[model samples]
Target chain A: MSGLTLIASYPKSGNTWLRAFLASHLRDGRPIDLNADLSEVPNLTSRSLQDCHAGLEHSDLSRQEVALLRPLTSRRIAREQPGFYKTHDSNLVPPGAREPAIPPDAIDRVVCIVRDPRDVAVSAAAHFGWSLDDSVDRMADTAFCIGHSPRRLNANVEQWISSWSAHVESWLDAGGVQLLMLRYEDLLADPLESFTQLCRFLDLDDTRHAVSRSLEESRFSALAGQEARGGFRERSRTSTAPFFRAGKAGEWRTALPAVLAERVVGTHSRVMARVGYG
Target chain B: MTDGLLCGWRIRSDIALPELLDWQGDDRIPDLVVRLGEVDERLPEGREISPLLQIDGTGAGLLQVPMVGRFLVRPSGGITIAPQPEASEAEIRLFLLGSVLGMVCHQRALLPLHASSVAIDGGAVAFCGPSGMGKSTLALRFAQHGHSVVSDDICVIETCEPPRVRPCFPRLKLWRDTMEDAALSPEGLERNRRGQEKFHFRAPHAGVREPLPLRAIFLLRRAGSGEGEGIQRLAAPLDIMAALEAETFRLQVGHALGRAETLFQARALIANDVPVYRLTRRADAQPDRWLDAIAATIRG
Candidate 1:
């Protein structure tokens, strides 16, 4: 609760869902406004936050410089602006950087949400307008990163997400921070139990009614309906479907081709099985 | 050593600053002097303003960019830079004129907005925003139409009645796609940093020597799909003040120098006297669609 309490996850891995529950829970079960209220657990990598702390524009720096600079700013954010923040950064060291962007000393705790790689591929594809094959390949790519600006400035600082398997393993192996791992499928199965665990981990009000009320407020249907009415600012610019498209698990059986699903499972088999994911 | 004009100040520097205009003002002891010297890793009595910035009790500031260099800025208008052996001039000049310039403005009690402004209707129409919000890109669009660019990254405000903007050089830093969209080639232009696609495209026209009256301020933001996109004037004083505060360059340095009241008054002046607006552009839509609308809005 002192340093940065990060809700860290890979993209399309129910990161927003956890943040939404926390947002409502923090307000004592207030009905959450999807767009406006999410700032309670704001994105840690947002460009403005990085720029203000870094004292220089990330757009002007090369990738290596940004990688080096992030850890410094991370410590600043920890010391000055300590609170809940969401990120999709892998815990591994980025390319050309000595340490992870968010070093251990800068973190109070980590609530890492990981989803089944197969479902993540389907969700990521729809969210990014990538084909399922491309999504699978990108998630398997060791050098995969997000928010990198090649030809223009990106909205957020670059995050070295690496491969999904590497991403999963990195946080699992992260030291010196209290970590709580949650499976996206488990959250979907029993929202009350999963979210209660989340609240307890973060030392919030963990009573059943409070947890259930927050879970009910931030349920998948409500979030989808809200996005349908007013667009999600966090939605990818290239997103083909709605930001909350098909929150169900096991949809890869239908949406994803067999080969693509196989590729995800093959590359991420060890981490997947270790996390009790299919 | 090179002599140049930046933010209406005669600058004599050992570093080459090609973006600045050749000094035309009568030499009366250069207002700012830049030289090569040793810079310490950290200030002993200085308080940390940010990860890379520090400000001492004397209101002097130190800025160190890891691979570039360190800029030691004093209240007496002296700057000392110790560059890395491998640092390029482009990278060195970037911080010298950018972050160092903002620090100087704070030291001089001037307001520097993190904006890119161009002359519209013979006055400065400033576009303020955080990085990647298209402030420079919009200025580039205006510059392409032959509008005189007042400033690229930091817009210095002369705390006068109308809050005139001191004209910096018309060196706009643009990304590769932006230049391509504007039909300008990036082949010969120098990159903002090595291995970056962003190029420094200098406007062919010489910069206006005199400060232009501050006509309007537009805070640029990107709207997501299904969200409203247009220019809406901020009428509330708090909203305008908040927007201006958000866009103030190196605002923390100002506060650290015990200039919070001065900055607050500066923000109050903009909020009270000038018309500030929120201009929203769709993230996926054609960005140039707003050029004409912005011109019309500014003209009105």
Candidate 2:
């Protein structure tokens, strides 16, 4: 059986933070280079991986064709070894495609990290350089997507995030793969507990000391310091804001406008209630 | 050997490649022979091979291209194409234009760059990058600005005393978005294939049949926030070599075919003779703006 575990999330959720934690924990006290060390958890939708399987460039394929072939390509990638992949795409099957974005049988485990849609809106707005209202509206849209750049091919796959509620519901209801859900607020409130639980889910050593050490190393300050010293490669080339901007969970109260927050919450009220965000 | 000119080579093919402009009317002796025949699923055991291609000890190799066909290329400049039974004429035509032609160039010891070029001031300037980096789109912009397109996708370079680039087909494949951006209706243009939204636009002017002296090579890269859109000359030899290596079509396949030394020699020769520049553009930058900038750099 293949050993493919996914660190799945919506955009601007705590996906990167979780990766940082896992990377630091796995390194066992070695200094973590946010850019270099994080290579272990590669993007699931990497163009290079797809190109290797397709025997042609991803740019040669239309978006629909790419989506259709992603499952097979991902399965091939997973066959190589046990590895973790980061994905922001929802679990929904692409329109007119039979299978979901991440094929069920290809993945062994999925660790889904979710943040409040309001907070996600604020962070997404900053990360993508969209206005707060625009970001909120996108979060409410059922066809919301990222990495649909018109001028150039994106390194990552076109993620179909849909709406905030739909994105969360799809993953939660996803079949076949083992699911372990984690909330950003819980991680912020108690990193040691949350990450230790995550470690256990991933079948890694969850010793208290290891968890504490990884938490210390992957602290927002550490990641921000590294980005400050040498810029983050994953940062959007267009965005002026730092990739690790404002890692606080509830900053949306002050950062996101009241109307935008209400819009996100209203749009995602049912899922928000289910996830304890309501 | 049969007789015809293909990418400046006199060749004969059993399968009629109508996409290639008929350069010979069965008169001249051929430098290469291409026939349709059975190709093995895999190369003979213990041979050097890429995932998609393989080369025997004698430089004969097989290319297993998806959807189009399996091709066996011989060291003696002969080729055998075993197209999939269901493959359409369009599919075979496209593969012949791209990968098959590229492999033939590699077998012939020519450098087939993953680039598109246009004739500027009697010389060919090329835009090179991975697919979807706007190489053809930029070349179309150049053609629209009245420059003659030297090649559409693969720019075949013969590394001589001064390397020269031979033209391929005179068609530019543009995505629907790019066509709309250029304000051209996609009404009559041929889609790259039936289902794909990419359309092939024939250049208004014919592709240059004669090889032109190579002038400048620009490696297309996405601009960072700190870097503005423009052309920056690559002064370092290593950088020039790196750029050339990055854009060489089927480089891994070339290595598998035991042509690594030949490819290296070609890269060195071209790097020494040509001025390589890095053309950086923002994702949303206007094509005309950067086209003008690239033209100015090439003219200089």
Candidate 3:
């Protein structure tokens, strides 16, 4: 039976982009509408978990403020087909830690998006309103691999890489989850090839040529045009801005200063080389 | 202390009412006073009283009911005079005494969830859902169907003794709309003028005292019109957690640590002891079908 495919990634790691691409590619060559957003999708988060059992035990959370995703995480594998979803809680401990992570059987495939640590830092800074220095500092501290500083903490890139490494290690240790590693740069380099590989993993039958055409059809310019003119509102939730950011790799090299870049390289030099970024 | 009309109790404690501007009571003061008549009927001279807060009173003429516990005495002839005994502390202490906390503190008991519980012939059926998901409405219907009223709103479970949930109530409450929609008997209906969403129906003495072993837990949902089966049950912990969390109340209770542990234990009891199902019904559907299905499951 086809199980749920989780478009898993650290926040802002292009999970949305992948989802949009797949959704648009799957439909009969029709562009996926962004009108409904992630929530309108079926079997989204269960709102009940927040109220009945979770509330009294967790009264600090208001009924309206609780999220629908926390409760639905366990129901992922139970569906006839795997459900695709996303999350941002980095502290989601290993299954044995405090609360159990997502159940094992529910997940058929786990696709984690790994970007160059420096680029992740830059994207995080712009998207989350975090300064480059603090992002790097906090990131490094969280991964427990390298150092971070506020003023010119150069370890941004290294820490970014280390965070991904830890995430990968944790998922691998968990076992039973089919892991597919994707580099953001590779997708940017050849959208068609990347789309073809992802479709194959998801067990879809669309040809590479068709996927390439679809990718070209759904390019940053095309996607942004739909976003700017509200044409994509049928599929996307956020009306304020396009989900597609700068599709270029190494934008962080120029956006993030030399000091931060040096720190990234210092912390993630080995992983960078492993991913051929050295 | 006897006030001739209603008994007056005073609790002398160090705890002070911070909201009151000038509390000159060096001795004891009345915190909870359950008066029998309307506020207009009785009043002692030089006494201060405020209409009940938070509660839209259905049984009494007062606008609000005292929370937890407070002093109860009749107001005398617009008197607003005389020093009344203060027992806010004693009331809270008594509340916590008869309360689930009282049972737990005394016997390490668990608190039953704050939802509606209905007692059928052999066992009780609990309607567990968020506040506005029609829990009380369904429970009230079950009671009207000659099922014993285990609880109108909140049911307390005492796991230590006989493993039973005691239904506590001064009265059974129903919403105005529910009463109209269900076509329930209006014999004992007391219209609550304070709020549109509340009313009081005195629970029959027979239903109040009878205890039913809880047999089934149902999570209610509106029917979805589609190609798929509108409703199907699945044994998913996530669904249970999701349903329960929608109604979870004390995430962090009173700065205490083990409060969460107690809550988890209560959650586990419902999860382990009873069968839970997601019951979907159309707008015009009667709730008895779902109740009967649960009852059949319990019988099996």
Candidate 4:
């Protein structure tokens, strides 16, 4: 395919896990290094990657310029370095840009993994050094974005990820590309079946052995153990907790405050219900 | 009189270039001429080497930035700028000295490494890495400790025996936090772009007037978890060759200019002559601690 195959999701929505699974599967279920091997599916918003493709430094560019430049760069990457790329970018057009960061023609397909916003809120609070309330508010904020560190350089480029619902709808409703929407809970409940579907969608070997061995290699315990042994590069420096913290789904029930949970549900209830989070 | 002296080249420009050093040597003719002209949207026979850049058969390149202007860089050291109406002089000069300077290096058959450098005992030591790897931060740190800043972003090197780095501009594009941490004020400094917090800090007194013999290169990298953070020299010949090739600035433009074989020889010469080290630092940046270490390593 002459376009990008995106493993797209909002932050803390099992995007890393999917990449890990794919990384192991691509290596034929070999044990993978948490830091070294994940580059098999590099982040689309990574600063170096964006700079190399755009032929300009994003640090020297304004947010508006970056917004306009991303689509052109995306098309270039689609034509040249076409393959799987992980991204948190929303499909909607950003303010002052003609199109989304990655246009439809630039995309071959998207496998979007969604988590329960309540759980996302809890995990995000730990990962971004925010409180549960702050996380919930950010998830509901229509103007929310990431990787634009105002005072310093972030490792990745600016990704326009609006509200959780807007982000979810952006990829799922996107046209002219193949879309596979999977819930994070489904992957936890049945890794074999879910990853089998994932492999098939990506045109990988979907045999039971292939799926099961890759699943075992990318099991939450193994990944978390690797992270515990050697820290994850993707972990935020400001992150208050481990990157592989609490991989289970219903942690929000115990971790999130009742008021904050209600706030997330109030804003993302429609999208949540549609994705079977209800 | 020209506005700036860059890499021993006297630069006469149609626009302001406050970030560069004053022209010092006897001026026979300007090594580079920058003129304001009506540049066309495209170049004749220009193939797109990058999103903003195109190179023609004569090795002339065109660079078009959306808000900034288009730059036509010819092999004869001529640069024509057709700037946007609202573009700031600082913004225009930034690309002229950055991407355009890199293009000029390829045109002139010089090697440009994407690095930030400072003088250590009259020899240039370079730090190369991806953006946000604190290359400029490290240079700024050394500058604070009384070392002369050699160049930032693109370090121009003559790939002769015992390669020499032509001292370029003394401007460092530092982020807001780096400024605060380095105890430098960004007040009245120019931002790299409009509404961006990154600043183009001019270190006037700390500029090196002459080229320094290229001493060593340290490829800055992050120490992953449980990994040791220190400098390790590259031993294998192929690894050194690969590192030099990887660190070359605007390598694609060199290839597009049909200078790939020359570039390969340049990389081979650098790899054979200079000692390259992989300097792994922890993700948490503490450049002050490594300043003395870098200086000592360079001296050795």
Candidate 5:
């Protein structure tokens, strides 16, 4: 039995933040270097791993081929060592495939971090260089996905991000792996309690001092400063905004236009209420 | 089975690999052989050579390639392939040309580099990198700019005095995006495989049959933030060695075949014989600008 913990989330969520916090806490309250230590939590859909396993370039693979082989490849990698991997893909089985994108047996536990859709729209708009209306439309579209660029290779595989409601619901009902749901808002509002629960879920040492220090060290302000100095590698090429932009949760109230906010709520209100975002 | 000359070696294979340029029929003994035979899904008990390759003994190893097939390279210069049940012949042939052929080169003690080359002013200029780094795309851009294509994927380097690169084939495999960017249509071209958007465009001019003297090698890299787009000469011996080693095709298999000495010799021969440079370009930079820069540098 391999031990693999997944830090799964939708795009523009707090997946990277969670990874940074985990990396800092794991290193015993060491100050996190955004570039150096970020590799501690590698992305599940790394291009090198996929190319090595598939014995061909990822661009040569069809979308379904990439989807079908991704889980098997990750399973093979997980067998080598136990570690955390971040993914933005939804938990869904491809056409004619028996397993979802992430094999259940390969993962022992999953920490799914979800953010408010309104905030996600605002951040995604900046992150992808899309207008606010377009971002909201993408969030509401059931077939929305990332990494469809035809110009160059994307670091991650083609991720199927269903509508925000469906995305949250699928992970909640994902079977086999033990699931621990965390809200990005809770992480911002109460860092100690939220990260404490997270550490407990992963069976890490949740001492108060370590958790408090890690929370302070991985604060958004600190990460933003690091990005300003060295620049974040994960920032999209088209995006002009920095990677760690506006980590506050409720800024969407001011950032997102009224019509777009209503649309996000109208489409994702059920999941929002279920996750207490409403 | 068909007979063809690939990288100056006569090859007979059970399947027709369209990527390799055709050679005149001959009675000379084949330097390599590829045939269909049963192969185990996993390699037999042996030392793990590379992540995807394993060797049980000298000159005998198994290559388990995902989605394409399994290959067993025997000491007798023959390769046995067991393709995946669902893979098409087109897909199988592509992998055979890229990875399988590279492994064969290693078994035969030849150095195969992961690169694409274009014949520039009667000399070879090679671009080496991992896949999807636009190696083939850059080569095609050179060909479109009237430079002759030398190779598409694997550049075979012979370790003779003043090492030379033998042209592999005349086709450039391109994704749909690249074809569209170049304003070429994929409507009539053969796709690499069914459902894959990649198409193979045969070079408009015939490839140079005679080996070209190695001129210079440029390692392609995407420009990082705040980094300028241009060619920087790699002068340090260690840096040049690292760049060459990173581009060695099926490097783990080469080590397992007890060719480490030969591989190191080839790297040294190339590093010392040719000037190596790192060409960094913006991801969105116009291809012509960088291509012109590379041509200007080579001409000077």
Candidate 6:
């Protein structure tokens, strides 16, 4: 049992695919269908506030008083047993509201999947049921810089493009943690190879055959089926919403209205160029 | 390049960094590294480097904390400002810096605690809980009433021999929703650059109080319909040990038996020697009642 490995991604990034691949590998090439038994390791993100409170009461004496000063504080806890934890939030300095949710210092390794912002905007729009223009607009608000100031800094697509770069930068800066960046398109192109590399970085033996059984083209179909049946969404312990949405990369091409697509390309041209997407 | 002074405890890394990078490259190396105080324009490259909490000094310990992410020059020429990372802006960077620093330091002198600490009548009181448990809100409420806040969200717990837990650092962090709920004005809170999500409070030290003889440890929760009822005092040292460790342990500091762990265990042993109470408060009700109960316990 080592520390928890976090598969972190911006929402709608290829986090689910990575998680599925790893899960499949860990399960030894078994088809981790919708009926997979995830009772052993629960989703911290989906865990209900009520469940956490109730669960605390039944804790053994060691858990009752174990001080969690660091977000990765559960390294010891995981050393006793390794579990997979996934999160969308970035690591914080003073342990912001989200970081404290898990034991600080508990994350032994982090796998980040970065996609072109254009693709991300398109993916985000479809998931949130927003129009392409609306998604691009939202991404441009530069994280909604509507703080107390009247002058809203109009950060166009450049800011959105830099968002992922900034995120990966922070993770790398924080030493003792290994970060693996995977492009969404690259993952979509070759699921098995992508997952195998991910496993190697995570230090998990690739013998699990997670990709072999899942197949390539069927991966998306299976994921789509899972999403249709609300498999990934169901796995979420929290009642927030379904997680699996459209997993396509170039969805913005047709899905994004022509005008909005131009605005996205226009604004994030630098960023798009960086990821070789523009 | 300005002279860099080594702080209280200096850790030098063998890994050399490019002459310039955003923030300090390593938390284990030293707290602050300064090239140019306010005039420095070098920003950390790559997405991983955060703008908050840079290492600046004559060399190492002799340093300045940036004010509102800007260097504030003191009239007396002592430019030591405590820069609280904008919660909404650099949440991840700040969090990671604190986590890494807290880890490499080995919880020896600086222990990270998943609790909120506030200076109260001649001592400090810490409320420990997990996320969504309202630790920041509780601490902010007390701070508003003139109780000096030592740390919010995460408190660096420093312990001396004989086992006294002292909170180092002055700041409180709140979610956007919590700030709204607590009615705290966001005029002063800093916004993060990347995500318009969270905010950080720059706490001003107003009241003078001693490192409280660990007052009382309360594991908080939003009381439900039926749960542990009433205010019951936990008498067993073992029970106290269990509860305190769960709430206060910094696992990132590594080692199953670090000095900080030993000190914390020792403090809990003494705390178990003291009074431990469970205050079941209405989730809908204010935290005042629990505060009053803690005061009474401390007094008695």
Candidate 3 per-residue C-alpha lDDT over B1-300 given as tens digits, one digit per residue, 9 for 90 to 100: 322110011322234321112323334444333322223322223221121211111111111112222222222111111111432342332222222222222122245455677776666676765544667777766666677666644555654333466554424455555667777554544432221234556544344443456676677665533212133554776666556544442332211224456556566666666666776665446665666666666566
lDDT of 5 by residue, A1-278 (tens): 25668898888899999989988988998998887687778787778666664444666666766776677666766776568888887887755456677778778889999999999999999999999999999898877878666545577677777788888887898888899999999999899999999999988879899899988889999999999997887888778599899898888889888888999989888899999986
Who wins the DockQ comparison? 4
User: Which candidate model has the greater DockQ, 2 or 5?
Assistant: 5
Model 5 ranges off by over 4 Å = A1-3, A22-37, A79-82, A129-145, A150-152, A160-180, A196-218, A221-232, A237-245, A251-274, B24-26, B34-75, B79-88, B256-258, B295-300
For model 2, what is the alpha-carbon lDDT of residue B268? Answer: 89
Per-prediction count of colliding residue pairs? 0, 0, 84, 0, 0, 55
Candidate 4 residues lying further than 4 Å off, grouped into runs, are B1-3, B204-206
Which TM-score values does chain B get in all models?
Answer: 0.97, 0.91, 0.58, 0.97, 0.92, 0.62
Ranking by TM-score: 4, 1, 5, 2, 6, 3
Best candidate, TM-score: 4
Candidate 2 lDDT, A122-176, residue by residue in tens: 8888888888888888888888877666544566667677888898888898888
User: What lDDT tens digits, residue by residue, belong to model 6 across residues A67-125?
Assistant: 12223223333554467765654443321123332343666777767777677777666
TM-score per prediction, in order, is: 0.94, 0.73, 0.43, 0.97, 0.83, 0.45
Candidate ranking under DockQ, highest first, comes to 4, 1, 5, 2, 6, 3
The runs of at least 3 residues in candidate 6 whose Cα sits more than 4 Å from the true structure, single-residue gaps closed, are: A1-11, A27-119, A126-131, A137-241, A262-278, B1-114, B117-125, B129-133, B142-177, B186-215, B219-265, B268-271, B274-300
RMSD (Cα, Å) for all candidates, in order, is 2.2, 5.9, 18.6, 1.6, 4.0, 14.1
lDDT string, candidate 4, B1-300, tens digits? 455788988889888787777887895688899999999998988999887889999889999988899999999889999999999998898899899999999998899999999888889999999898889999898888788889999999998888999999788999999999988889999888888889998764558888889999999988877879998888887898888887889899988987788888888888888989999998775889998787777777
Q: Clashes in candidate 1: how many?
A: 0
True contacts kept of 5: 0.08
How many clashes in candidate 4? Answer: 0
Segments of candidate 2 deviating more than 4 angstroms? A1-6, A10-12, A19-42, A52-54, A62-85, A89-111, A115-155, A158-181, A192-278, B1-4, B11-19, B24-26, B30-87
Candidate 1 lDDT by residue in tens digits, B1-300:
558898899999988888888888886899999999999988879888888899998888999887888889999999999998988999988888898999999999999999999998889999998787888888887887889889999999987787899998889998999899889899998888998899999987668888899999999988755678999999999999888888899888888888788888988988888888899987665767888988888778
Shift in Å, residue B284, candidate 3: 36
Q: Per-residue CA lDDT of candidate 1, range A1-278, in tens? A: 68999999999999999888889999999999898899999999999899888877888777888899999999999998999999999999997888999999999999999898999999999999998889999999999999876887788999999999999889988999899999998999988888888888999999999998988899999999998888788888789999899888889888888888778878888999999975
- What is residue B261's positional error in candidate 2, in angstroms? 1.3
lDDT of 6 by residue, B45-110 (tens): 211011122222211111112212333222122332233453222432343233333433342444
Give the alpha-carbon lDDT of every model. Answer: 0.89, 0.79, 0.48, 0.89, 0.81, 0.49
Q: What is the lDDT of residue A89 in candidate 1?
A: 93
Model 4: docking quality category: medium
